[model samples]
Target: QEELAKKQAEALKIQKKNDELRAREEQRHLAKNTRVFELPLSRYKRKDDLKDIAACLGLDLNGKIPELTSRIKAHLDSNSVLQANPRFCGLFG
Candidate 1:
């Protein structure tokens, strides 16, 4: 029915609005709570930066830049160290 369709459309709109608001809040939360260590691996452009991150993550620092990056990524993925926030996980995972 036309009435049912109208109500459904209205409900969908409301749901979408709520989803947007929740996503915005999540971004704010992540911005406030994110730590330096949670930064994406790509952000560490320099080898030294990656080395520092690897050291902090207790990863082996003996490899090349790409190797180190991959190792760190693998460790994070397997351990779920950044599992709390899926948004943060997407940044690096």
Candidate 2:
């Protein structure tokens, strides 16, 4: 009846508020637990930069720009040898 509809609507409103609160709490928790790191790439790089990076990382890119970029990014992500190289290290940091 009308009373039942009113009760259901009130319950739904409460549930919606509870869901919103939970979402906000989860977002706060995630922000608090997150860690961020940043690396700097060279400014004003040209074709020669890619070629040099490929050479230092020993990646063969066959002169393709997309492949060259991805390979360089991957190498910079975790290759200690590339990171340690004074020449390439300057490019990244």
Candidate 3:
């Protein structure tokens, strides 16, 4: 009976640990999902187009395509004046 009690205690400890880990993982997933980003620019049909978009967004040319696109979207979202610009709107929207 003593051994059974010890085993039950161990099991309870492991179960509690597992529950904590699950909760932490769920929190991480929720945080990731809640993050807001956007893809402002479409695909580049030419290399020059890619350069122009990066220049216009003030993002580094070395950044990945998706990251640059997201930054551009965020910029446009924050700056209504940029959104109002005909050239900027034509390129991104």
TM-scores vs. true structure, each candidate = 0.48, 0.43, 0.43
Q: Report the CA-based lDDT of candidate 3 relative to the real structure.
A: 0.59
**Which residue pairs overlap in candidate 1's backbone?**
none
Per-residue error (Å), model 3, residue 40 = 7.1
lDDT of each candidate versus the true structure:
0.68, 0.61, 0.59
For residues 1-93, write the lDDT of model 2, one tens digit per residue.
999999999999999999997885555445432322123554525654465446545677465766777777777787767556555566566
Identify the runs in model 2 with alpha carbons over 4 angstroms from their true place.
Answer: 1-44
Q: Each model's number of backbone clashes?
A: 0, 0, 0
lDDT of 3 by residue, 1-93 (tens): 999999999999999999997885565455442332233466454444454555655556456666666666677678778656655665454
Off by over 4 Å in 3: 1-40, 43-48
Which candidate number would show the highest lDDT if scored against the true structure?
1
Candidate 1 per-residue lDDT, tens place, 2-67, comes to: 999999999999999999978855554454433355466677777766666665566676888889
Residue pairs in collision within model 3: none
